[model samples]
Target: MKRILSISLLLLFNLGQSRAQSEKKIAFGPYIQQMGTKDAAVCWSTLVGSMTVTDPSGKTDTIREYKQHAIYFQGLKPDTKYSYDVLNDGSNEGKGTLTTFPDKIVPFNFVVIGDTRTRNNVHKKIIEQVTKRDPRFIVNSGDLVSNGWSMKNWESFFEINHDFMKNTPYYPVLGNHEKDSPYYYNFFDLPNNERYYYFTVGDALFIVLDSEGHRTSIPAYTTEGNEDAYWEQSGIEYLKKEKEWLEQVLKLNHQAGFVFIFQHQTLYSVKKSRVEESKKVRAFWGDIFSRYGVQVFLNGHDHHYHHAYDKGVHFITSAGGGAPLYDIDAPQPETVNYKKIEHFINVEVKLDEAVLHVIDIDGNEFDTIKVKRRDVK
Candidate 1:
């Protein structure tokens, strides 16, 4: 009788522990990523080992995975809104609504914001403002956290920007600070599962590349040792494959009318930190973009705003996403404009033309320009 009582007591204790663990629940996200016409990737963090995703179409999907929950809902209608619920252990953990990419070449807007590292207050404010603008999606030029390898930093980012992330799809490029961390890769469900990839929204083909993919060694940028960190450099030395891929993709999709290429590091910036890297990219990839119909190259790593036009290609550095602001070094004569402030770029796409607006953190429009599409002839 005593043995039976002890066994029952042990079982009750184990059950109590399990219940407590379940209460801890999600760490960050029940957010959206990789928003496509027929599907959308929903990602969240929890240790429950399995979760359920319920869509507006009365479809339920059971995702069996570990901490990072990445589940895709297929057969969604283009340009349609779908409300979703993320449930864990039979309890509703998170709920948000997201819309798929437009099927037709209709007018749309996408905001570019980046370098949001270790600056929670500004990042939160930026998120609030961007949410109000209600762009179809968002593009982040990397450096989402100060320490990409640390899970805590990522948690803080999601904590501050969950509202926007849960609702809108954020296409993130690889930044130097992300350091190729597995957490970075695991958190986002992007196209190709590789660091560099592309997607189309409306008539625009958005190509995202990893500029640091060529680094032969990892920098000392993480709390953990460099051995454990996952930093790389593929943009310079080992960029042959990416270059071929870029050319192939551009050749196939140049008919899309607009090609916008983005990465964490720009090929030209007033800051000296990125001068060498920029030169290499310019020599290697600049002609490719010019040869193709690439319209704009967007990047954010200089922590300031600078733009220029060369050979029918518009180069923009919109890296002002709550990171420490940098003073403009020697300004280049080719620079169309330069600004030292926290800001984001809003790109409004029409059929024949695209408008780029640079808005500061104080809700001020500092600069705007319209780029006419290049005639393929």
Candidate 2:
């Protein structure tokens, strides 16, 4: 009887494990982190059809199904409250809440960080800090890799903090690590033709550029494997297209309040492995932003923080995401021309002002800067 009972218990335990796996949901995020998205933005991994939007009064609004197309939620009101859920069939996957912003100049807030590869738990901790401050959205300056863009790292990244991602609409810039696989293309539904794309939030038109592709497309680097030919062997061809796209976006949103360009790799850096961005590439984009009045450029590559400016554009380099650190690459000898901080930046855009505050993983204020785009009444 003892032998029979022991065998039965072992069988029951195995069955329980099996059931857990079948129902095993990796719950990541369920918070409202994005603003200025009228109704649609890329859904990436979120199940659009399964999402349910609810009001504060508990009135639920069902999301219409999206069949195979990239997920973009529509029919939402401006600067309004809505609770949501990313469901799997009739079952639930995760939940979140969000507020939409108006088309014209509206006040908003956002956070910025980058190169969060190999530091999965760090991302989680950072999210915890960010929630306390209650900003609008988050920007990951890309390089979310663990060794050359492996699928494992990508999966590990989401596994570690799907909760934060689900809750917040992360505006990710393309980094060297994202090249690990075609998973970014498959997993993330971004704007524009390629991963290097653009979107507008409030008064800002966010452009995500690809530094790896830009650098690697040089004749010295891309004499082979020209298979990914969106442009010629020269990455310059691609940047030109991006420049043209920017011109169009600018012309289209001529009355836009601000333009912030984000990508991996800093315009200036102290990391030995990476060189200062080729002036040619910088000049092309820099001139356009200057010509069009983009106020800032945000980037990450040398897993550290450095902020500098050329002409009028503020370039913020924030690449420390609980990963190992790097030394500063100051451009000037007398003046460093860069503010270094190993923390995330919170940008608050009110009806009257836009404030940039840098905070540590513990939510400590490291630095602050406020830019006035227009006159306040």
Candidate 3:
């Protein structure tokens, strides 16, 4: 009897272990990306061999291949709330909430922050503050991870960003620190091959560019696989295509109430390493923006907060997303405000105007700027 009982207990224990192992989920997101007026994309990684997404109205979408799933929730109404879930083998795995973009110009709020390369504890704090605001979505200017090639870095980011990333749609630009890693590209479902793209939310047009692609030729920043050869192979082509695309996009959408461009490098930062690159990129793209009447250009890389306005354009360096802070060396006349601290920018867009607020990690607003939407006719 003792021998039989011991054998039965061993079998039961093994069965439980197998069940637990089967329950473990795959790493990373089920976050919102590529949000639109009537549809949105949800992406996640699962090794159970397939992914299934179920919406509030009981509509289900499924994908049968790949370890990662990019499921689109289509036929949704404009500016409506949606509750969604991800299931693996028909078992609930993850849940998130989202709101579709409004079809017309209306009052909306969005948060912009970046340079979250390290210091994950502080990054979590900033995310906590961001969650409190409950903005419609969040835009990251870049440097999301210290080493984008490292899976550990991405795991760390996803672990800490669970609160916000899981629920709020994230639109991120590519930072130099990202190194154009496959991990970076695989993590988000972006338009235009995830290099650079533009999207309109309400009446505001947000343009994301590949600054590192365009500015790789500037001075001492060349690497063996990342320099002229890289440019000749692909960077140059990408830059040219993006420039032409930008001109056309701006021309067609010139009547947009607001045009905001975001990237990884700053056009007017006092930081030492970025000086030459900044000048080069400014020369390359500044006139294009001015000609198109781009209202604001947002970026990260300075690891601080800065605001500058030049020739009818606003230049904002908001790299305060948990990276080590850098100070201003020499403030320019166009610099309206500067701060060395962890912070994020909140922009509230209205039909004819917009409001920008610079808020620190402690949840204090230090500055506010009001921009009137330009008449494009």
Candidate 4:
């Protein structure tokens, strides 16, 4: 009986190897979730039907069966590191990680990275450093890959960011470059079938929007453009739809400590050229943010980072993902705010005010913005 069991195990291993060789390399993720307290969300892909997550408390929870490569995990502990891993079958040891989130609402820390396309080696090194901080989760501002439309480009994105996504629940906003590709909407597992969506973290309402619409005409949604700027039409319809959704979400969280809008394009360009045309976005959405008392609009474009006061809208651009920086044309547009950098933002939400740090590729702090929620009122 022992001999027979050993033979069976050997055969299974061979079959697993063979299957892996035949199957397409399943891509990973760039979005993660971190809520108030110990709550967290994670997503992964498996050749098998489903997977399980074992927490620090020794409690194992099996998530729903997945047809795709991603999903979100929540209800985790904060400010404490936890051990976790991925699984395909019973007791088969797959890769794993040591993960953690910041302690609940009183004060918390999070990292944002955008345009991590070139020198992937550098990006990996940067991510490794971020993990040491044990942030609750990560926010990818936009331009996750160099080429937005290629399957290979996206696959590379998932491969490079796998370190953060397997354990950390990631949140991604579609960038203009991302629209250059078709795989994005399908590759990511967002709340809605549409690209624009929202999620709440503690005392803040984080609204992710599409800025291309701030520049061009909206794409038609009913029928995908196919070759006819499908995204353009779809974007417009979606924004119209999202407008109603935003109204509802704001009404629900009218008193939240901070309200933020994260998107890929800036309402105002860094060079400040074509101000009249670009300003329409702020003309279109900035008022909504102001009316709703949005704290900031987190944006990316122009490959540099900067911030400024445009009326009541606070604009931020953290594009420094090593994706070939652009020589920004200054003077910007007719709208409220603009800036550029190859960096990210480390945001801390507080009772008295909210703080934002413009951080560099190595997690170095460049500048800071301290805003009082009371003043907005």
Best by TM-score: 3
Clashes found in each candidate (C-alpha, N, C closer than 3 A): 8, 8, 0, 40
What shift in Å separates residue 171 of candidate 3 from its native position after superposition? Answer: 0.6
Q: What is the per-residue lDDT of model 2 for residues 1-377, given as tens digits with 9 covering 90 to 100?
A: 00111000000111122344436332223323323545644333322224577999999965432122233456766656555544433444544455565555767787888877866777678767776766556778887665544545655676665656655666677777666356666555556665577777776667777666654433555445664452434466666677677688767866656667787867756554454343434655667766777777788877776666666777777887766677655453222334444578888876655688878777787667666674211
Q: How should the candidates be ordered by TM-score, best one leading?
A: 3, 1, 2, 4
Taking all chains together, each candidate's TM-score versus the true structure is: 0.83, 0.75, 0.84, 0.72
On lDDT, the stronger of 1 and 4 is 1
lDDT by residue for model 1 (119-157), tens = 789988888878778999999998999988766688788
- Candidate 3, residues 1-377: lDDT per residue as tens digits? 00111000000111122455556554566688988987888777654444677999999966433256677877877877777666423434466677888887889999999999899988999999988988988999999999877766887888788768767899989998898788788788897658888999888999998877743443466666666455545565667788898899899898898999998888987776667667877877758988888999999999999999988899999999989999778676678889888999999998889999899999999989888998977
RMSD of 1: 12.2
lDDT of 4 by residue, 155-259 (tens): 567777776665565677777667545566656666654367776666666777655543344445535546345544555765776678778888888877777
| Residue 244 lDDT (model 2) | 74
**Model 3: CA > 4 A from native:** 1-21, 47-66, 88-92, 214-234
- The global C-alpha lDDT for each of the candidates, from Candidate 1 onward, is 0.79, 0.61, 0.80, 0.60
- The superposed Cα distance between candidate 4 and the true structure at residue 326, in angstroms, equals 1.7
Question: Which pairs in model 2 have colliding backbones?
Answer: 28-162, 28-163, 29-163, 30-95, 39-73, 79-100, 149-180, 270-329
